[model samples]
Target: MKFSRLLAVLALAAGLSGTGASGAGAAERVRVGILKFGTVAWEMDVVRANKLDAANGVAVETVDLASPDAARIAFQAGEVDTIVSDVLWAARLRAEGKPVVYVPFSAAEGSVMVASGAPIRSVGDLKAKKIGVAGGPLDKGWLLLQAYAKKTAGLDLAREAEPVYGAPPLLQQKLESGELDAALIYWNFAARLEAKGFRELVSVEGAARGLGAEGQVALIGYVFRQDFADAHPDLVKGFVAASRAAKALLAGQDAEWTRIRPIMRADDDATFAALKRRFVEGVPSRPIAEEARDAAGLYAQIAAIGGERLVGPAKTLPDGTYWQGK
Candidate 1:
């Protein structure tokens, strides 16, 4: 009888221990997705350096994509919990009934136009010329570029010229071959083009400022499905914290480029240094009024180009929607 009682006690202890361990395990592991962009590199560095994800039991895995369209498709198929993409793209997804929400202010305005051989001087100079764009008409970068053109030179891009569609790498090659005049390239890739003898036609910083007519406004941020966010509130908050830490480190002029450079890309010091210096002055701490204004301005440009209304989020996000480390 004594032996039987001891065995029963052992069984009960084991059951309790097993239940506790299971609960703990469930609380610790969270799967997240990220892109292979420099923006994500900074955030990943924060996660690893601060040990934030591990401490919170979060396991973050980035899903690499070759194109924006691919990233959108993956997010829609439930392959990723979150993504680092433009606010407009997220807005478009939400409009398509996917219900993704922009993660407040989480972006660096890294979109810019580069002119090959200094032929294009300003955003307006591209009139009657062919411009290379990755996505077709109504592309996010194209829309923003249109807004800049309108604000800077009073030239409406919708009536100006044609946009040639091709991916950045292909477009860069086209520019190099003189097959294309100029291209709307992301800042990271645009910097590479500059290294290869391309010149900056315009920076999103100038465009953002010209369009908003106030503080800086640019499209950049983190986004996630609403259902995922509702299901993982703590996880969302932790992710936001990690993003803030990353941005803070990158925002510093004295940031350890030696550490960050390799993570961004295996580029030479000149390119990395130039890219880092460019972003140091103008990166936003949070998506605030300016982001909303910029979003509104971009939508207007898109509507003008398409001659139809766009199905997306609010014209301007509310002030509280974009805040740092929120």
Candidate 2:
């Protein structure tokens, strides 16, 4: 682990420095590892299309990976500078003695879904019904839903309902085929299901609000080693600014999303439009301090449910996990 981190630090320094002779003429490059279909790809396309990263003094490069787990492996081996992940996983790494820095990526927490015509009207209605939960028992969305059900209705999903863990697409299919009474899934899948006429039982974000979060919470983020940030503070900040700029463009313009629709895999116009709306609605608008504070509280809530299997030793977010850049 130490050796790999050293290699990553050195590689990042080289990527940031550019050619010594070119000086300011060359842009600081950031090689980000991402799943080919991950949402980060859409932002990278915008950043590259509009030269947002270059405008911010950085060049954005993407390394395509097969899966999120593959991206993590590549990131740890120093094959790439960063990957998109949540503060929970980052905190787990820190607690286990690895240091990293997190930059907010998106605030799109997913939703709980039921068939549009189903009789299940609320979370309480899901009692004794089968629920398909994507990302497993430790998935942040599932944990939040569990917390919400317990707090709002005193319904313990673990005992009152059956949860079958599976991938997002599979869960969506099962719900459509009547195999699942309700499914708590990732945002993009929820958007797709919405296009197919599914009704939301409750949004993870909405549940979070009921549980006392002041505003939207951003779970996923762009994470890189701390040493890399220390070595290239300006570059790291540039990446963050460029990301925000890409999001701004996508949020405001319908054309930007239209251009990326092919990659979105939206089978129809309704799905395409729904995805665009959900993505725009998820843009983080809260202050950094508030995001950090809410994240700490949410972590405690999930830790109480998932225990050591989910969070390792640290129940709350460890210090220095969330980045407050200059």
Candidate 3:
């Protein structure tokens, strides 16, 4: 009888231990840093609202930051396991031996906007005009514009246009008030301008191709420490799955836009609808591996534009920079 009792006790302990482990696994959380007005905000918000992380067997907590620099600071301080940033920044970080890897997130969606009735009708007409540039003078959009102009029109925009650097919101305001002739604004800001009767002169994707990158290059992605991804491969896969699911949801359902419209803070219904359309248009349809070659080419284009400051001295896309196999 004692032997039988010992066997039963062993079985019960095993069951209890298994239950404990499952519970712990379910509770494991990953913190991600994001900027308030970045491209990642929409998808991250969708993931949180729909409980996609929980469904995928992981928990994610998003930290809202004020600026891109703040997000970098939070990541460096170990307050966040991942951040939503561009591939160029990820390449720079990995080049510096930071053990960073990028998971493809959003397609390039910025464009140069001009007043509907403005005299500037072509890229060549932008010469000698006041151009408002977002994310500062060395921003990717500005650099791409410079390259596009020099390559296509044989004009140097940097020497021709009076480049005024400022935040996206401020640039948009200046453009509306006629303080600038044209502005190379971000995706959302460009969408808002379109709603207000502004027109796109050229999209970032077109500009990139004009500067020698392959078709539809992905510019932004989710970045994380290599150690964190290695330790929790399941979490990384789950996160990617959840993100893709969110992208799919946004793609098929107009109702999903309603859920995220509040976060966009659009000034009007037209602006909101335009922003939603622009955002959905930029969602990636395939994994990063499928676009590895194009991504490498895009990286080279960005390096050429910004030189050492943007991509460091490497001037090349570092190996293992693109996350493969989920």
Candidate 4:
């Protein structure tokens, strides 16, 4: 009788151990690196606030960094599984054999904004005017604008306009203060200016279209190390799904804005509304897919305009740059 009791106890212990092991195996954790003010912050915040990751059967840990560069460093050091960044950066990394893959996060791009009362009615009107260009002269948006001007307006903005390089806020200030007649600014800033009656000379999408690229050329995306993605495909899918769900909520409901409004810290109702509109406009309309041909065409255009400095010498999109799922 004593021997039988000991056997039963050992069997029960083995079953519990197996159950615990299975549970541990089922709950995989994924770590994502994000910047405090980066584009992905709002969506990631939604995911965490609602425990979306847990609902999706994965444990997500968000590591907030000070800036984009800090996020990049953390990702490179294997401290985080994924980071929010531009697709072009992912292409550059893949070109350097970094084994990184890009997943579409946002499709919104900046635009060229002119003062409401300014005489700049078209891209051609930018001639001989002070144009505030963000991210310097070689910025992708500036380069695309340059290409658009040369292609559509039959003039070179580089030679015609006095390109004033500054941050987006400074550019906006200069435009408002009558120092800059026009400014190429991000969508959010452009939206704010539009709300205040500024005229949008050209959108990045419009510029790209004029340059012959088709469809929405996604500028921003989430990049992950290929090894990590391969090791935990479900976790990656879960993250993307959670992010997409958050985006849907933002797109469909005005109530969702209240949750993220604190993070935005808008000074007034008008600014908040404008920012919200811009944010909703930026959400991808379709599921994220690998648009290799479109990406390749846009890359060619960028390479032609920016040369070795912006997109490197390859002038072509790298293989495995887009995550096609498991």
Best by TM-score: 2
Which residue pairs in candidate 1 collide?
28-57, 34-62, 105-287, 106-221, 107-220, 110-187, 287-322
lDDT, residue 207, candidate 4: 88
Tens digits of per-residue lDDT, candidate 1, 16-113, equal: 11111122233433333444564565656555555544555544444455555666675676665565676666666655566666754433453545
Q: Which candidate comes out best when scored by lDDT?
A: 2
lDDT of each: 0.58, 0.82, 0.75, 0.74
Weakest 10 consecutive residues, lDDT, candidate 4?
A: 1-10
Query: Candidate 1: where are CA atoms >4 Å away?
Result: 1-29, 55-59, 104-107, 110-119, 151-159, 253-256, 279-282, 287-290, 307-325
Residue 311 shift from truth in candidate 1, angstroms: 3.2
**Higher-lDDT candidate of 1 and 2:** 2
Give me the overall lDDT of model 2. 0.82
How well is each residue in 191-274 modelled by candidate 3, as lDDT tens digits? 999999999999888887776655566778888788877777766777777777778888888888887877788879989888
lDDT of 3 at 92: 88
lDDT per residue for candidate 2 within 225-287, as digits (tens), equals 888788887778777777787788998888898899998999999899888888888888777
RMSD (Å) of each candidate, 1 decimal: 10.4, 5.7, 9.2, 10.1
Collision pairs in model 4: none
TM-score of the candidate numbered 1?
0.75
Better of 2 and 3 by TM-score: 2
